[model samples]
Target: MEMTKKIAIIGAGPGGLAAGMLLSQLGYEVNIYEKNDRIGGRTALHKMGKYSFDIGPSALTMTHVLTSLFMDCKRDILDYVSLLPINPIHTLYFQEVTFPLYSDYAATKAVIKTYFPGEEEGFDRFMKENTKKMLYISPLNQFNYSSLFDFFRPTTLRAIPSLTLGRSLMDDLARYFNSKYLRLAFSLQMRYLGMSPWDIPAAYSIVPFSEFYYGTFHPIGGQNKIVEAMQQVVTENKGKFFFNSEVTDFELEGNEIKGARLASGQVIEADYYFTNLDFMYSLGNKPNNHLEKKEYSSSAFMLYLGLSIVLPLSHQSIVFPDNYREFSDNTIHKKILSKDLAIHITNPSATDNTMAPINHSSIRIMVSVPNNTSAIDWDKETKEFRQLILDTVKERLDFPDLDDYIEEEYIITPKDWEEKYHVKYGAVFGLQHLTRQHGFLHPSKKLPKYKNLFVIGAGALSGSSLPFIIENAQITTRKFLQKENPSNQ
Candidate 1:
């Protein structure tokens, strides 16, 4: 009798967990090792005195990506987690006016009309064009391509009229509407990928379509509930999860990954290994020359606040300064926190009461800052920076004595994230989603020197979104299984 193959997955983030679950479902014996005590790398929730906040990825878009994962397992995602649609997905606050982006096209258009009355036709045209762009790029997202050149082939060329990476997202919108407020509202979605609209490829315009078309969703309990659901699937498939087990080194035999050595001085061997840890970090303490040559993504500074009083703001809000470009430049070049920055405020308790104490609220304020490696004095700077942000939020939103409402607060500077998550440079997203580093040019599952080793998550193809990471995991597992067992195919 042929023995069942064993697979070891490193990291318990969504990608690693999803990969382990799928492989186990395919009848392989899988073991998942997570360095952290909990699952969900960046998606984990941090609890304070009376508030629970989603430490990473505050919003959920592209529900179909998640649903497809459940469908593949011959189950429904809804059975695992309840998803609630959030209409007017988020409110964009600018110096001039505030606009709500609704799931319904008509409703969003009407909101736009309220501010720019005569520009309804323009808004409609822009949406139509944006939708066309999404339809064109959708195929690339769902399937694997051989190379960057392949995207310019005849079939892809046919869609070129709809695809536009030649211009920035801001420039594309500038062609449609002259209002800075409207422009800011639409372009703020670029920040979802930690990019600036002024430099981000227009091809990314599809981001808004994903949210508007599929609608933004929130898990009923907390973001961590999704992690629990993924874990359940893995457990149901007979996969073993080893939390708080840090992988210290890879046991290689003749350029093939034989197993891994844990920080606890134990060894776990497997036929194949899948790593969801940050690509750079997974290369072991002393990396080979090639691994060291690769680049990394931008880091972030996040502040999780548990308010003593309920905040009157919406579930999601982006407070933009007059000079959004300066903020973007500061993040990209200076690696400094912008004085007039873009702030993403989320009060999950508004949508799910379990997040905070009765009549209280939970809020998180995120600002793109330099990676931890930068020479900024976070120890000395954190207090001053937090105060600046608080002052700015109070003035912009006109909250009455907002400082008094803080019952408990926790801040994750880039240094904290780097030390905790092993994310090189404290980058939340594994790699930058630039034109050169996107799609096919992104890292591949097949390791350069190791035959049985593979990579998954934001560092690999499909880029750094929850849905894409999950998708990449599924794709990598399927490919590996097919390669290892031709009879199964």
Candidate 2:
């Protein structure tokens, strides 16, 4: 009889759930310790009265990555979550003009040609080149790179040409077309990762390409259903869960972790340990490893509106500010709280009836503000900022009398994420994808000091997007599995 390998995971985030499902299927006795009474971490649902909203990641992209997770467990994708395609994937409200980006390639190309006229050729060329680029590097993001030497391995070497050197993601788009609106539609994907489009590496052009190529999807109930589904997979395979159990610290001897100490003073012993906690919150705290040198991703100011009526709009929309260059610069770099803010609105109820009351809207707004480090006072300014966003949405989009229709409202600022979510400085996107901070430069999935330790979530291997974070779990779990087998013979 063989002994079952016992593994303990510290968070119940999508990354943690992903790891638990995979490891349990591989026959590991797993226990996940989540601080909250509920699962899903940021992926969890937010409810105010009868209104339900997705607190994080309002848009679902790269859905094939999620389908692959269920397939790995030999389960039907539809068995866990039902997905509905969003036709006009996103309608861009760029100042005065309205652009509807369709899911169909021919339709989107037609829209681009209609608006910008001469730029359809550029869109066609981009679709051709970027499709090849994504094909080359998509496989590379799924592996762990322990060092620069590891980066030069076969997969990374093969992806070198697609790496997009000597320019930012914004500059790369400029090479394709002259329309800033078109450039913006493509570039918005990477910025949501808390990086400025002009600052992040050009390789992330894959964000929009993947979304347009694969099309966008919404779970029948909510994105949170995916979290619930993963939990089912974990327990069915014999994995255990401990909710509301906060990990206070770890018991370590030199480079190896022996056990994890909970807040109640009970320590859980395991053969191998993995934490789904945020990169900074897990480490550097009294109970976890912490590095002072690591910089964090930017935070957000979010509003979830439970309205009496739905707006006449697409499923998703972005309302760009008039001065986007200055807005992007100040929001990220100069650390100014601009009254002119770029707002993203997602009306989940428009597509999924379960998210809100009959015909009522569940609106999620994300305004990319600074992390908590700024001198500006959030406590005093939250009201004004909220009003500014609401005013802009109502006035600019001509959604008349929006103030009259609000039935309930919920808001989360950077301070809430820092204090409640316990992320490092409330970084919404985890680590910033700067030239000095991305790729092999970010934290490794396997910590250098601890032999039986691993990590997952926003800050790991791939960037923090849901699909990419799941890929991080796949990579981390594969390493442990390979180590267990050692050789096929």
Best candidate according to lDDT: 2
Candidate 2 wrongly placed segments (more than 4 Å): 277-293, 445-448
| Residue 343 accuracy (lDDT) in model 1 | 81
lDDT of candidate 1 over 31-85, digit per residue (tens) = 9998888888888878887789888887788888888888887879988898877
Clashes by residue pair, model 2: 249-287, 283-289, 283-290, 284-289, 284-290
- Tens-place lDDT per residue, model 2, 1-489, is 989989999889999999999999878899999999999989999889999988787767888888888889988778988898887888888776999998799999999988999999998888888999998888877656656787778887888888887688899999898998999888885346876788778888888888888888899878899999999999899899999999887887887888888889999999998876453254435443334455566688999988999788778888888887777778677877888878888888778899888979888888888877677678898999999998899888987877798898998998899899987777788767765665666655334457788877766654788998899899888888777787942
Best by TM-score: 2
CA lDDT of every candidate = 0.78, 0.82
Q: Return the TM-score for each candidate structure.
A: 0.93, 0.96
Clashes (N, CA, C under 3 Å) per candidate? 1, 5
